[model samples]
Target: MEKEHKHHISSYFAHGTVLVTLLVLTVITVVVAGLKLGPLSVFVALIIASIKGTTVLTYFMHLKYDKPIYRIMVFGVFLLFALIIGITFIDYVFR
Candidate 1:
């Protein structure tokens, strides 16, 4: 398969989008942290971080057009991690 040519213009847009998203999410995280959401605060922060990570991986890391299996694998990894986190959270909260 032929490699697609990446245009400089698109790169600018992607960079800008990533920057804006980072700033917006960072602000949100800070605000949420100050709101005292109880145990859910950690989960909310993690969810935001996950979104940022996936944005970086899918766009900056060029995984958006990767194979279907690759996408599935990446999603599966996130889900597995989330489940583990959930279990630990449940244990801690119930303790």
Candidate 2:
């Protein structure tokens, strides 16, 4: 017989908290977009987006309670994406 692994169930309060945080972040993003900070607006938007993405991945996607391998894979993918973006920017700058 195989042993079944029990999953951790998140509370409604936790989900609500995440939802509220995402909503707040959305408002902040909109406010930042209205500021017209030139290049800095994009950077601020990206940072806020990253935070919202991480929150969704951790809570709604249940990545926080997932196995180590899954977390590692997600982190690797994020790292790869960041590296690609960095390289693209560098190429653009040098051209």
Candidate 3:
């Protein structure tokens, strides 16, 4: 007989908290966008977006309770994407 694995169940409060945090972040993003910081506006937006994405991935996606391998894979993908974006930015700058 195979042993059944138990999954970690997140509480309703935790989900509510995450939802509130995401909502607050969304408001901040909108406020930042309205600031008209020129080139910095995009950078600020990206930073805020990345934070929101991480929060969603960690809590809502249940990555926080997953195995270490899954975390590593997600991080690797994020890094690869960042690297590609960096390279593209560099190419654009040089052009």
Candidate 4:
């Protein structure tokens, strides 16, 4: 007979932390959407939205508790995205 070992990979969060964060982010999004920041507003909104999205995905999706491979996958996705963004900027700025 073989002994099996179990590990706890999940996190137990304090209740409503996510809900509160969501409400706050929603308010920020709405408020920022209403304000006019000229050409920079779009960029700001996207950045802020990304932050909110990351928070949701990381915490809600339990990405934080995933295996190392999951982390690598996320890094790879972001790295590819960053490469594309960097290339676009370089091309735009140099042109």
Residue pairs in candidate 3 whose N, alpha carbon or C atoms collide under 3 angstroms: none
- Per-residue lDDT tens digits for candidate 3, residues 1-95, read 65555788999999999999999999999999999999999999999999999999999899999887789999999999989999999989999
**Model 2 regions more than 4 Å off:** 1-4
**Tens-digit lDDT track of model 2 for 1-95:** 65567898999999999999999999999999999999999999999999999999999999999887788999999999989999999989999
RMSD from true fold, candidate 2: 2.0
Best by lDDT: 2
Among all windows of 10 consecutive residues in model 4, the one with the lowest summed lDDT is 6-15
Error of 2 at 22 (Å): 0.3
What are the runs in model 4 whose C-alpha is more than 4 Å off?
Answer: 1-15
At residue 43, give the lDDT of candidate 4: 88
What lDDT would each prediction earn against the true structure?
0.84, 0.95, 0.93, 0.77
